[model samples]
Target chain A: MRILEIENLKKSYTTPDGEILTVIDVPGFALESGEQIALSGESGSGKTTFLNLVAGILRPDGGRIFLGGEDVTALSEAARDRLRADKIGYIFQTFNLLQGYTALENVLLGMMFGKGADKGFALGLLERVGLGDRAGYKPSQLSVGQQQRVALARALANRPALVLADEPTGNLDPGTAGKAVSLIKEMCAESGAALLLVSHDDKVLGNFGGVKDLGEINRAPRGGIEK
Target chain B: MNRENVGGIFLIAKKSLAQHRLSTVITVLSVALAAGLVMAVFSIRDQTYDAFTGGPAGFDAVLGARGSQLQLVLNTVFHLETSPGNIPWEMYEAIKENPNVELAVPYAVGDNYRGYRIVGTERSLFTDLEYRKGRKLTLAEGELFNPEKREAVVGSYVADKTGLKAGSKFNPFHGLVFDERQKHAEEYTVTGVLEPTNSPSDRVIWIPIDEFYRISGHVLRGGGGTYEPRAGEEIPDRYKEVSAVMLKLRNPQAGFLLDQTINRQGTAATLAWPIGRVMAELFGKIGWVNNVLSLVAYLVVLVAAGSILASIYNTMNERRREFAILRALGARRGTVFAAIILESASIAAIGAALGYAVYALILAGAAVVIRAETGVVLDVLKPGPALLAAPLAMIALGILAGVIPALKAYSTDVASNLAPLS
Candidate 1:
């Protein structure tokens, strides 16, 4: 049932004046399939950094990440990319589809980069996300909420084992945000996919079953979350 | 990748390109411009060679009375100018009898009609000289001339312009140089009309030498039957003789042999090779300059390559986000690299195709204009090594243009791109 495990993960960055900045240090963590987890933090508390690290986008200075019992952190960059493409899906808060591609094209764009998902399956994914009629519409033609649905459809198109969404509903209204989270959770639950939602939203934090606060481990919270 | 996936990439590329119509149009236009330039250069070069080579029908070398070699070649091989001196019909007969000679054709060109020249030659000319498509001279209406008959075979242009086909008649024009005959003594029936040769022959009026002499003698007499010299002076021997003889050799190598024999043995005769004379004249005037021009063309091509590189390099800045998106979607650095390269190569290929087509069109137009104005015919289509150079260079250039961009794409960091930029 356990899907992802991270141990002694440490990431750092170099400042302009040559200072080394250690950003994140998570001792250990584990998640099971169909489990939803919230990573909550104040501003500048390395929430996005942790997500990028776990997603295999960034190499930790020292760590071991086990996704589906496979030691992914020990793999090469190219091998990591292949593993990520096969097993993981990411949803950004901004819904960053290519400017020229239509909504259906953007959803299909992800599958075009993956292994075996076809065009018809991609279109079916769009229909599942309630954007079937808006398939031909470009990102420019869609509202912010609709764009997020397109991004969600794109992320779930490959039926990935884990969905990592970084503040996916951050720019939407409470009404749209509530609908977005519930829809995303419904898809994740339907596919039995593990969800790692990175956000500072208290409302979202209350919704997830498992929650990890960065402040509790960092010893000092950088800022307070509203409400 | 599956076929479906490849189709997806193609669809994305095509749809993206379609959306950016302005940029696509500009890129396509640039390609077309380059293609046109390359095509024009090749077409003109080929056409010029064809027109010059085709105009002279089966003549290996021209033998004439000792004078300018260039003049003899021009008159006998191209029919462009008059020969400086005549080789008397007797010498023409002797060359024809030589064991090494395959066939000998004689021509006496010393008269013109409304700018078109009058040529006096044997009837064998109409039968033996074949034009393009292996065609022989055939009268549209009447019979050909008899050896004793005062009849002429008017060419296609002569018939069209003068309305004189086989059966119509006309008086001979005055002089080869002056065009002022005091008395027109000989009148000839138009016995044959030639098909369009698309060469200088298309504008000529062919008559027998005897008929030419009868008119010339009478006209030079100044309104009387008795021919006279200019106030007790002797007439030049050339004035009373034929212009030049066009000879076909049993072997092409006989041209060199005949030239050597004439220069070494004949006291008053010389042989002129048309190809040698024309190439000599051409290289003498433009050979040195041609090297400079070729160097310039090569430099222009390099500049075009550089421009392509510059265009792709500039575009890479705008494509960073796109590359990042692909990376996040699990595209390996090499895939992104290959995609950039593929895009650059496609543009170059499209451009080269367009440029080549434009070049061909311009060359064809130039050929037509040159033939119409200067009577120098050129073939618009001919395959040559020089024509292939541009497209090959362009494809190489396109690959070169993709190099830097491909490298840049391969070096992009997925880590930095996962979190949206501030």
Candidate 2:
């Protein structure tokens, strides 16, 4: 089953200097169920833009996005948000856990905006991430790797069908970065969610089952545009 | 909790508030104090007005030396203000002779025992007068002062403060103030103590009318030449005077006749009919004071709301990413907006609820001073307009104050804010 299918996807933004900058113009893309694929791009390749378009976080200038065969791009902004909440889990480069909430609460926040947050399941997710004892610790209290593990658990919190990650190990040292990538892949595979991770680090890309280059797939002019 | 669950907005706001615990607590307490102050101001003003307008019930009118009716009511009815001047004893006798008058009691006040008013009157003042509608004065201890003897009937409050019980003797100062040097040579025994009437009557030290005139310093200002009475000399009726005369009419309607007959035409006295109306008018006269106090109360609430706005807005700049994270997680923009508004209202709701305690504290403090000054004991638990409405208004204002910050949160850009902090 195809978790996500996109065709003729395009996005652009006007520069502060008033010139139009085209960043992403991908002709086609598809990810199979539970398949983890990595996409690499230099800084200006608009890799994050593609993830955002697929996650329904941003509107494509023109395209269609089908998640589980349902056309998401045709939905209203609010409806798209609903679809994203119910079907997509996103992991940021730096762990975006709420500083005030406990580690368990951060994971629960994923399920919070979805159907509901089950305390027991959230605790189990924390335990699976090996931070069950530190469930009560805030993100500020956890180590860098531990925080990422909590984020990984949170990403799978809603039992998402597709997971989009943008430089998930960008902040980790090379050693911890390798471990974090392995943990992310293992966690995503266990949850049976298709994974699309974007990164510039070759070490991080080398761990994925397959990798794609954003520069080759997205046909927009680079213009040193921000990803 | 933001919006989906029972704990949505409150739970999330609670966590957010906890993250800035010090500022949150400070803002809440400021709001509490403001709510309390506003409620207290309204309460004290209203109850004080009620106490004054709801003065002692027995007297329908007060006849005093020709002067301000308010001064007469204050001096004669409330034991406040000095006597406007002295009315001749003949005026009391003349009003007493009216067929419409049920009873006329005279009061001659010029001295004080330890700052409490010393009111001299006939025995009929206590025996025949009712402090409330159907309640005559009762003695708490000892018997009523002998009408012809040198005896004092202490009011309950005077007795409590001065410890003036039966067999106690005290010299009166020359005026309505405490003075050791100006004490009269004559001393009077406390013959009785009055039960608490919760009225001005509770603050007076009552004595015989004859003794008040014979206190050695009263001048015979009647038709007779001014003659300072010598000891053992009897002051003639033609030489006697009373400060004010309280009249209980055969019916309340007859007070209008008295008001017409003496106050309207005769220059001998001023008649204050409908005593409560007189006090109400007195309250109206001092409405500027009420307006100033109310302004202060409203200002405090405004400042409290402003503080809440400042507290929430101050941290808004730093929480953009947090909002973005929630947005990306599936929170609708309205959810974050409502959450911010809900947080502010929650702070006010908590503060306003606690405000009643602060109201109790303030009212309790104000009660002591009010009772001392006006001799009226107020029931603190009495309900008024401020009881419920003020707190609700505070919450509404809190929500209103949250709008700007909530709008800021509503417009937070998820894509930009989620960009890694460089």
User: Highest lDDT: which candidate?
Assistant: 2
lDDT of 2 by residue, B1-422 (tens): 43444344555788888888899899999999999999999999888788788757468888888889999899888888988998788878888999999999999999998899898999998889887878999998899988777799999999999999999999888887778777888899999999898888889999998888788777768654786766566777887788988988898779878888887878878998888899988788899999999999999999999999999999899999989888888887877898899889988998899899999999999888988998987767999989898999999999998999999999998888886421
Tell how far residue B234 is off in model 1, in angstroms: 22
Model 2 clash count equals 5
Measured over all alpha carbons after superposition, the RMSD of each candidate to the real structure, in angstroms, is: 4.7, 2.5
Q: What is the lDDT of residue A5 in candidate 1?
A: 89
Compared with the true structure, what per-residue lDDT tens digits does model 1 show for residues B152-193? Answer: 888786688789877787776665543554335567888888
C-alpha positional error of residue A185 in candidate 2 after TM-score superposition, expressed in Å = 2.7
lDDT of 2 at A162: 91
Supply the DockQ value of model 1: 0.44
How many backbone overlaps does candidate 1 show? Answer: 10
TM-score, every prediction: 0.87, 0.94
User: How much is B173 displaced in model 1, in angstroms?
Assistant: 5.9
